[model samples]
Target: MIQIANRTISLATEPFVIAEMSGNHNNSLERALEIVDAAAETGAHALKIQTYTAETITIRSDRPEFRIEDEGSLWSGRTLFNLYEEACLPWDWHKAIFDRCAEHGMIGFSTPFDDTAVAHLESLNVPCYKIASFEIVDLPLIRLVARTGKPMIMSTGMADIGEIHQAVQTARSNGCGQIILLKCTSSYPAMPGDSNILTIPHLRELFETEVGISDHTMGTGVSVAAVALGATVIEKHFTLDRAAGGVDSKFSLEPDEFKRLVEDSAQAHASLGRIQYGQLANEKTSKLHRRSLYVVEDVEEGTIASSSNIRSIRPGNGLEPAYWDLIIGRKFAKDVKAGYPLSIDHFF
Candidate 1:
């Protein structure tokens, strides 16, 4: 179990829900704080923002390498520099945004893209750090964040096991003992078919750390399914209104959808009790309705019991149905009436 700012995250508790406010703020600090308010109202445990500027993240060039060439990408044909300029959350707004998160009883943190960004967050004294999927390969940044001696949540999108091993090793070797791996697909507006969340448990087993899902799918279904598969955390991009439209709005969930995700994920986690197979406490009364041997027809004393008079029926206050074959030729000990429950004491 990992504790972050007084909250315990483990399979034993409800899945830690995070509302990613990534460029959904659209450069407006007021809107960003509003997103925080809305996320808290949706029962989100935390709100995450990305920390970096266009210059820090990319070069100001429209060259071929600087432009996103993938036709399937949401930012296709856009220069990486221009895209980051728009999506990067301003550094000056961190304190205000985090303060608002505190007002709503939610933890606030950011995905620092560079060592400078990490220092900025460290100054704010963030309780934990988040390593974005793209940054998992940045050993230096991982080393810096790990040395902070706080819990680290890393997204494993498009990363192979070897890459994950290096990131985990760097963090652990540097002093970050509390770690959580978020199984992510990395695709903007990723499809549920692509979200192989079964990897969540496998990740936990392989890394010996908490596991979760950073879902990009369209609904709460995949997130809830992840919870059942033992996801200790769930992160989804959040926007106040998809209709308003922002950089990440196409894949981001609206407030209502996020609320349902929280409710359903919690319920799914609660339902994953233990490996149990016997009748439960709630089933005690219902068990009485189970099929049992009963007298379907009248039978006089000394009469041989037969299938015509005895049968398996409901209301389990009788001999078990398993006894039917053995008692088939047994004699009735009394003048049993129709609808009588069959028991060993009722037969000779």
Candidate 2:
């Protein structure tokens, strides 16, 4: 178990929810602070933003390799440099945004893309650090962030077991002691079927660390399912309104949708009680409403008990239903009214 700003990340507690504000602020400091307030209102535990400049992440090159070419991609025909230039949060706004998060009673953190980005976040004293899926293979960057001795959340999107192992090893060898692995599908507006959240539990077992989902799906169902599979943290892109338009708004959840995700995921976690069977203590009254052997009609003293006179019915103040066969051939020892529950003493 790990604690992020007083919120405990463990199966024994409510899932720690994070509202990812990646590029959803639309370059407006006001909107970014609003996003922070909205996330806090939904009971989310943290607000996560990216800490990188376009210049730091990429160079001003028109090279073919720098352009996004996938026809189905969200940023198709856009160069990585230009896309990030428009999407990157300004370095000057970090303190105000994080301060707004604090005012709303929520912790704030960031995904550091490179060495400079890590150093900048350190100035703000971020409580934790998140490693983006695309950066999972960057062992040097992980080592740098780990040396800060803060908890790290690394998203495993395209990373295979070997790569994940190297990253975790790098972090631990440096100084990080608390780590979480988030199962992720790198696709924007990712499909629910592609989520493969069953891997969440396997991640925990494989790395002996907390596990979660960096959900790119369109609804709360996938996130809720992750909690049932032992996810201790859940991260989802959040925005005030998808209609307002932003780099990631196409796949981001609106405020109300994020609230539902928070509530439903918590309910799913609460429902994961220990394994048990048989009647429960709270069900004692309900058990009395079960079917049992009783006198369906009327019988008199010295009368022969038979199937027509006695049968299984509701209201459990009677001989157990299992005794029906044995009592069928017995003679009544006393008279019984139509509604009287059958008892072994009623027969010879």
Candidate 3:
């Protein structure tokens, strides 16, 4: 189990819903505060942001490999440095954002890209740290964040089993005992077929830690499905309005959609009560409506019971349906009325 602030996140608890406010503030502190308020209003357990500057994440290079030329990418034709510059949240804004989260009773944390970012978040006494999918291979950064002894949530997007093992080993050796692995599809606005949320439980079993999904799918379906499969944490990008247009607004959920996610994911978690086959309390009353052997027609005393007089029917106050064949040639001990429930005593 992982506890962030006062919230307990585990397979046994309700899903820990996180509203990732990544660059959706549109560079305005006022807008950022509003996003925090909106996120809290939606009943999300926590809010997360990215802590990095353009210089901290990448250099100003015009190399072909440094540019996103994929036509399928949202930032097509943009250099990595330029995109980071536009999307990077200012370090000076962390305190205000964290303070706002505290005011609203939400846990505030960030994804640290380097040693400097890690130290900065540590000074703020952040409760936990998240490792973005792209940074999963940065062993040095992982070790630095883990040294804080805070809970860590790492996204496994493009990583294989070996890479995940290395990252988890690094964190454990460095001091972080509370780790959450989130199955992630790195594509922006990820497709449903590519989500593969079934990995959630496998990740928990493989790493023996809490598992979740950093969902990029358009709706809450994937997240809810993840909870049913043992996801204990759900992180999705949040934005005030996609129409307003920000770095991640295109794939981010609006306030109402996020609220639905919070509700639906919790419902999905509640539905996974346990492995049970016996009738439930609510089902006890309905059991009477199930089909069982009943007398379909009136019969004189000493008359032989058969298909014409007895058969399986509803209102289960009768012999079990399994007894139907055995009772077929038995003589009736007493006259049974039409629609009467057949009992073992009625047969001789």
Candidate 4:
């Protein structure tokens, strides 16, 4: 189990939900604070930001290859540099954002895209660092982040099992003992079918570390299902409004939606219950509603119990139905009245 900001995060407890405010701030400090407040109100335990400048993430190249060429992508025609520039949160905003999160009692952390970003976040003494899905293959960067000795969370989006093993090995080799692997789908506005949430338990078995989900799907359905499958943490993009035109706004959950994710994820986790079951504590009183043997009509002494006089009915105060055959041919020991609960001694 990994502890973050004094919170014990593991598969045993309910999922720790982190609301990622990545680039959804729209470059405004005020908006960033609002995002933090809104996420906190959603009962999310943590709020995450991305600490990277465009220059740190990529070069200023304008070549056709430097721009996204896929027509289906959200940033289709935009150059990577320009897109990152617009999406990047300024370094100066980190202090206030982190402070506000502390004031609101939420864990504040971020994903470091480069070595410099890691150093910058380290100076702030951030609780943990997250490695974005795109950077999973960047072994050197992962090593640098791991060397900080803080808990590290790596997202597995486009990575195959072999690549993920290499990343996990790199983090462990570089001195990071507390590591969390998140099952992720790289697509923006990912579809439910592509999420493959069932991989959560498998990831835990494969890596022998905490496993979680960094969801991009439309609703809380994916997040809740992930919890049901043993995901210990859930990270989802958050925005004040999806129609506000931020870089990740389209796929991010608004305040209400994120709140639902937090609530429903916890509920799903609680519903897992223990392996053995007869009746839960809350169902004790309701157990009386179950069917059992009872007298349906009046029968005098020496009367043979028959289908007409005895029946399996509700209000389970009578003999168990499992003894139905034995009681059917027996004679009543007393004058049983209609609607009376049958007892074992009533049979002679």
Error of 1 at 82 (Å): 0.7
TM-score (all chains, Cα) for each model: 0.96, 0.96, 0.95, 0.97
- When summed lDDT is taken over every stretch of 10 residues in candidate 1, the lowest stretch is 339-348
Regions more than 4 Å wrong, model 3: none
**Candidate 3: what lDDT?**
0.93
Could you say which candidate leads in lDDT? 1
lDDT of 4 by residue, 227-303 (tens): 88888999999999988889899999999998988889988988887797687788889968999888999999999
lDDT against the true structure, each candidate: 0.94, 0.92, 0.93, 0.92
TM-score of 2: 0.96
Q: What's the CA error at residue 7 for candidate 2, in Å? A: 0.8
Candidate 4 has its poorest 10 consecutive residues by lDDT at 273-282
| Clash pairs (backbone) in predicted model 4 | none
Candidate 3 collision pairs: none
Q: What is the C-alpha lDDT profile of model 1 across 127-217, one tens digit per residue?
A: 9999999999999999999999999999999999999999999999999999999999999989999999999999999999999999999
Task: Output candidate 2 Cα RMSD.
Answer: 1.5
* Top-scoring candidate (TM-score): 4
